[model samples]
Target: MSHSKHSSLSHDRHPLNFQDTYICPICRHGHIESLTLMDVFACDFCRHIFTANLKDQSIHVENSSQPMTWRWTGRNWQAANQLDVDLTVVIWLVSVSLVILPPSLIWLSSHAFPPLVGSSGSWFPAFWVGLTFTLHFLFVSWLMAEHYQFPLYVSTKVRLRRLLDRR
Candidate 1:
């Protein structure tokens, strides 16, 4: 729904065909659940997981070497929560646009304003404008990086997998 560049990819770019199907990661059977967010086919029968990203396909097979396990996190479950990677990308794009676009329009406006153009004064105003612009850009960049840097759902899954494997 967002006008962000990554919006399409985040929401509905890769529609998965659950019926086309792939092998289950756990039982090695041919029944896998299409988990588009994780970009993987998950085995419902044995809880195995694998990803079929365009770059490469990696399988997380359920075997003696890597057993399956699950855990509880004290948070309400939601589709948006599960799709953190996509959500983060969308947020980053929107935030960057918001930060850069408005000030740019204003800067252009000052140039177009004939009354404000002809006269010049101290360098202090220009210095202040540059300082504010830099601060705003830096602030938005930091926020975007912080928001997308750690997708909670994926990190949680990875942590749970590690814990389960240990036991």
Candidate 2:
């Protein structure tokens, strides 16, 4: 069984985005049939068919509907991941510089040691501050990614078409 239905109730009536259009069952290609409330669309092209039940919003596609072509619109997740990683690295660098480096330099200057080679006592506070900032940034980034669906929205499109004879 397909995980998602090809139709969207939001786009009813228009031919391009018709919610209840009938398609051929054999070839998985759309047929010329105009769908009505009583009729289920059947693909004549590739042994696919589907219908929406009136009483309860149930979308039923027959066994033949298994092999129908599925299309989708969304960002490529792998590409998005690459971009996320880049962003993460940039953030990490910024955090190290702004949060970790400056304070360490100040604390080091207070003691008798090199600014870059951080003193022992200064290490503790620096570590804590860096850890806290990193954790906080990570959490904010995670929340933003979740809320925004991290890069893009993922959606699918399926249609039934007639299996025409090529010979």
Candidate 3:
């Protein structure tokens, strides 16, 4: 039900028929066949259940944490709600914020509420800035790794071991 976008192909599609064997859009390996005497379809390989909308020629994955939907195109299935989130734009925005925000915040805070003359300690701002930069950098790195299919997210223990071995 969460799947909103219904991206259909230019070619026309036929409605679901139990006689035909449609490939499972979710697993991409199984055939989606209707369960005997049931309205829902089940994938043989992935065992994922799907509910069909014959009117729209769409099948929705059932009991999934994040609902996924696909439309039958009379040949292959296409994602119904694939957003194609661009990591490049996301990375760029995060990088820009990483370079700009911390320093700007420090400068604005200093001017907005002038620090006490004697109580001023530069270390606090420095620490805050460092923490902010580190967090942003880690997030961007993870996003990049995922986009590029890098092995950086292999395992926490492996990463810790690699970190310790660096010394």
Best by TM-score: 3
For candidate 1, give the lDDT. Answer: 0.47
lDDT of 2: 0.39
Query: How far is 80's C-alpha from truth in model 2 (Å)?
Result: 23
Highest lDDT: give the candidate number. 3
Which ranges in model 3 have alpha carbons more than 4 Å from their true place?
Answer: 1-14, 82-167
Q: In model 2, where is the ten-residue run with the lowest total lDDT?
A: 72-81
Predicted candidate 1 versus true structure: per-residue lDDT over 39-127, tens digit per residue: 55665544556544333223333332322222111111112213357875887788777677766765666556533444575444555
Residue 164, candidate 1: how far off, in angstroms?
A: 38
In terms of TM-score, how similar is model 3 to the real structure?
Answer: 0.45
Q: List the residue pairs that clash in candidate 1.
A: none
lDDT of 3 by residue, 16-76 (tens): 6654567677656556778899888887656678888888888888865656788877767
Give the TM-score of each candidate: 0.32, 0.25, 0.45
- Find the 10 residues in a row with the least total lDDT in model 1: 71-80
- Report, for every candidate in turn, its global Cα lDDT versus the true structure: 0.47, 0.39, 0.65
Q: What is the lDDT ranking, best to worst?
A: 3, 1, 2
Question: Model 3 clash pairs?
Answer: none
